[model samples]
Target: MRIVVVGGGYAGVLAANRLAKAVEAEITVVNPRPDFVERVRLHQQVAGTAVAAGPLGSMLRAGIATRVAAAHKVGDGTVTLDDGSTLDFDYALLAVGSTVEPMAGTVPIGSWEGAQRARAALAALPAGAVVAVVGGGATGVETAAEVAAARPDLRVRIVGSPVAATFTGRARRLVRDGLARVGVEVTDDEVVAVDGGDVALASGTGFAADLVLWAIVSGVPELAAASGLDVDADGRVLVDEFLRSTSDERVFAIGDCAGVPGTRFACQSATDQAGHAASALAAMIAGRGPKPYSVRYLARCVTLGRRAAVAQFTHLDDTPRDTALSGRTAAVLKELATRGAKFGARAGFGA
Candidate 1:
């Protein structure tokens, strides 16, 4: 069997590695870059505190081929690369992951490329400069705290919707306290415009920013839609219970690009989905029916710099619970979880 996996983000890498071990197939992973990006640690990269990427070859298991090119199109039983090369396959996995396009005047820290740009821009700024982070989700809060902790001299503030809005009331309070402990000012005002280093708020208030970082994820790649696959309104490929594309049984979609209901855009979910897809694919190749994919929510961990964090326990369906952990212990768990994610991807133990 010949299998081609597109994209090498958390989902793509984990799926490729798991598939390599689960089935007897010639696996080839197509990625735009030669390295695997640890997207969960991108905030650290922007703060100059950690390196989040390594050679892709080093992460994948032996006998799996790597193509350092973007996937231009994924057709039936074939994948077309950006350089006009084509690879024929019996099956394909579309795991292109998510993307973020910052506004004209803002830098983004969502993708590997954006993280590098943010790092350079942040490094060039002088001390006492105002750094405004737009968005109040996990990425936004993490980026604000990371930058504030790494460069205490800089004035860093996170402005947007409520910070950590997904967490429960107790967990949200913990996150707010953690942010305050790290000297990050939290704002609930919506940003209406970003122009010429000035951020205009919806309430008619504005502030001069020396640097602006956008932490919101905009959308996924257009490859699935462009290839005529059945995608949701957000352009994520719609998949059935088995993670196989609805329109093409030969293709499976997982991770951020897969329109799987109840799943969030996190490496934990991606790896978990990859593990299930591997098992399902293996079963299908063995002339047996594969089980439907399902995931149980464990906990959500958000790092507030290097010293503090908040871990919100969740029900099986991902709804937050009052039971939570905070401070150093939570930070340690967050670190362990991140390391475990990398190890799981490398060892093909995602399931």
Candidate 2:
């Protein structure tokens, strides 16, 4: 049997590696880049810090074939590459991940190459230049904090999002205080348009800046939908409880591309989903019943800077607890979590 995984991001890589050991089958991972991108550290990259990206070979288990090519299309039991080559497989897993929503003339940290370009553009800006980050989600929060900490001379502001809406009251207070300490301004308004070095808010407010960073995380790739796979309104592939596509049983989806209810695009969720998909596939291959995929949220951490953060403890369904960790301790934990996410796939399901 042959299995083809059409992506190499957190979900794709983990699925390929875990599936390789599940059965005696040929497993191939198709990716455009040769290295694994630690997406959690992309905010650091934009702040001109070292990223956790490394060669793909370093992370994948031995015996898994790696193809450095983009998947152009997925047909019945076949994956077509950008170079016109095709790979036939008994089963295909679509984990193409996601990209940031297009905000013309702004740098978005949703893709590997886009983050690199954003880093360069940010680094080249002059001191005291104003940088506005739109979208106050996790990416926006981290990017604003990182920028403020890294370039103290520059003015950083986070626009959009109510600031820590997912956190408890105290944790939300910590986030607010941490951003203030880093000299980052928080604006609770939506960005309707971005002109060259200018941002127009939905409330008719406008601001000029040297650079604009868009953190709209609502963007998901449309590959699956375009290829006729069942998808939700946001173009995320709809999958069954076992992570198999609802439209085709031979196809599975995970990570940012999967339209699993209550699932987010976090690294932890991706790894967990990938492991579950592999386990289900292994069971099917062995003629055993596959287990249903289920996940729970433990906690969510947002770095205010290198030395400050807010770790919001949560229930299994992600409801915030009344207590939260703040200050350097939370910062350390956040940093460790980001680092661990890079290699978390190696632990497989037992982890």
Candidate 3:
């Protein structure tokens, strides 16, 4: 069998590796870059503290072919690359991940390319310059704290509605305290527009920002939509309980691009989906019944610079619990979780 996996992010890489171990299909991974980017550490990359990407050749298992080109279109049993090349497959896994396109005059730190640009822009700024991060989610809080810790000379502020709003009340308080300790100012304001050097707020307030980093992800890639596949309103490919595309039985969608209910855009969730998809595909190829995909939430870890973190325990459905961990222990746990995610993708153990 010939299998083609599109987008070599966390989901695609894990799916390919796991599938390689389960089935005897000829697997090929198509990605725009030759390196595998650890997207969770993009904030650190922007802050100039860590490298988030490395050689992709070292991550994937042997015997899996890789095409260093963007997938322009995914058709029935075929994938067309931007370089005018085509690869026919018996099954295709669409793992193309999320993307971000910030408004004019603002740099985005969501993707690897955008993180590099943000890093260069932040590095070129003068001391005491104002760096405004527009988003209050995990990415925004992490970026704000990282920048403040890395460059104390620069003023860092995170503006959004109810910063760290996803966590429980107590966990949210701990995140705020951690951010404060790292010298990051949190503002409960909604950003309306980003001009050359001014950020207009929804309440008619404005702030001068020497550098603006957008941490919000816009949406997933348009590969499925452009190819006339079933997609949700957000352009995520629609998949059934087994992670197979609703429109095509031979095509499976996982990761950020897959419209999997109750799943968040996280590496852990992506790897879990990948593992399930691989197992199901293998079962079907072996003429056996496949199990439905299911996931259980463990914990959500957010780093406040490198010294502190908040690990919020969640219920099976991913709802936050009142109990949580903070301080150095939480930081260590967060670090271990990050390393475990990388190891899981490379070693094909945890999914």
> Which residue ranges in model 3 land beyond 4 Å of their true spot?
none
**lDDT score for residue 237 of model 2:** 86
Tens digit of per-residue lDDT, candidate 3, span 119-206: 9999999999999999899999999999999999999999979789888788999999999998888899998898889999988999
In every candidate, how many clashes are there? 0, 0, 0
TM-score of 1: 0.98
Off by over 4 Å in 2: 347-351
Tens digits of per-residue lDDT, candidate 1, 1-351, equal 999999887777788888887789999999999999999999999999999999999999999999999998998788999899999999999889998978779999998999999999999999999999998989999999999999999999998677788787889999988888888988888888899989998889989999999999979999999999999999999999999999999999989899999988888778888888888898999999999988777998899999999999998888888899999999999999999888888888866
lDDT of 2: 0.84
Tens digits of lDDT, candidate 2, 1-351: 999998887788888888877789998999899998888888888898667478987788888898999888786988888899999999999878778775898888867787888899989989989999887778888899998999999999999757656666888888888999999998988888887877888889889988898777766766787779888988988899899999989999988889999878788778878888988998999999998877778888899888989998888777778878999999898888876666666544422
TM-score of 3: 0.98
Alpha-carbon local distance difference test for all models: 0.91, 0.84, 0.90
Clashes by residue pair, model 1? none
Q: How well does candidate 2 score on lDDT at residue 305?
A: 83
